[model samples]
Target: MDLAWVRQHVRQAAAELGFGLVDQTKLVTAASELARNTLVHGGGGQVESTVLQNGLARGLRLTFTDEGPGIPDIERALSDGYTSGGGLGLGLGGARRLVHEFSLDSRPGAGTAVTVICWVAGPPRQRKEMR
Candidate 1:
């Protein structure tokens, strides 16, 4: 249920930001993957979505966090094929590749948090002459 919500939320945001079809697809796909990892691996978590703008470029950001047993090996976790659960192990790495920015934080006993952002090139910003 929550994962679906996550995907929907991202989709709406992408649409609202005028993201192209490719951008929308990438953002939603990344969000779904990360949300699933947050639930199955992190033992359930929360996601925060936000919109960003920089010089006419728009972006959607999703942050997922959980209080479950944190990942013990960050290196292995982000590696090509690694899974703490019974899955294909492409969730994290693949999700990261789909987004423009990705960040993950976890401690031995604290928990885990993953943040990703997908950006679309909006109209170019105008440059003023220094004359």
Candidate 2:
């Protein structure tokens, strides 16, 4: 999948969900980094984004999946300043910090799948009655 296109799609989705500018930027940045990792490290993969609602709260969830050489040490991978691709090593960790929920699944030869969710705090907004 194209990195830029993925980022654009994620940003647009966040905006459509009424995410504030800062929240939108955070989600976009995280999506961009993860998407690039999926392409460069995982030899290309798939990204899925969806809207989530829990009680009064709403959120956006993104999932990245790839069938490449999977991570052998998930903990080490999540550590700051640790990278296999000579990057700043902030993609996974940073992305985790930017969202409310984060999950990663991988094995040495199986593959990798990362899911993230960003939810708006407080109760859900009240809808107005139609005239």
RMSD of each: 7.2, 4.1
lDDT of 1 at 108: 79
Q: What TM-score does candidate 1 reach?
A: 0.86
Candidate 1, after superposition: displacement of residue 38 in Å? 1.1
TM-scores for every predicted model: 0.86, 0.87
**lDDT of candidate model 2 versus the reference:** 0.84
Q: For each candidate, how many residue pairs have backbone atoms clashing (under 3 Å)?
A: 0, 0
Lowest summed lDDT across 10 adjacent residues in model 1 is found at 120-129
List runs of model 2 lying over 4 Å from the truth: 86-89, 121-131
lDDT of 1 by residue, 1-131 (tens): 88788888898888878887787888888888888888887889899988888887888888999998998888877887776666545668888898999999999789999999888776633445797
Candidate 1 regions off by >4 Å? Answer: 85-89, 123-131
Name every residue pair that clashes in candidate 2. Answer: none
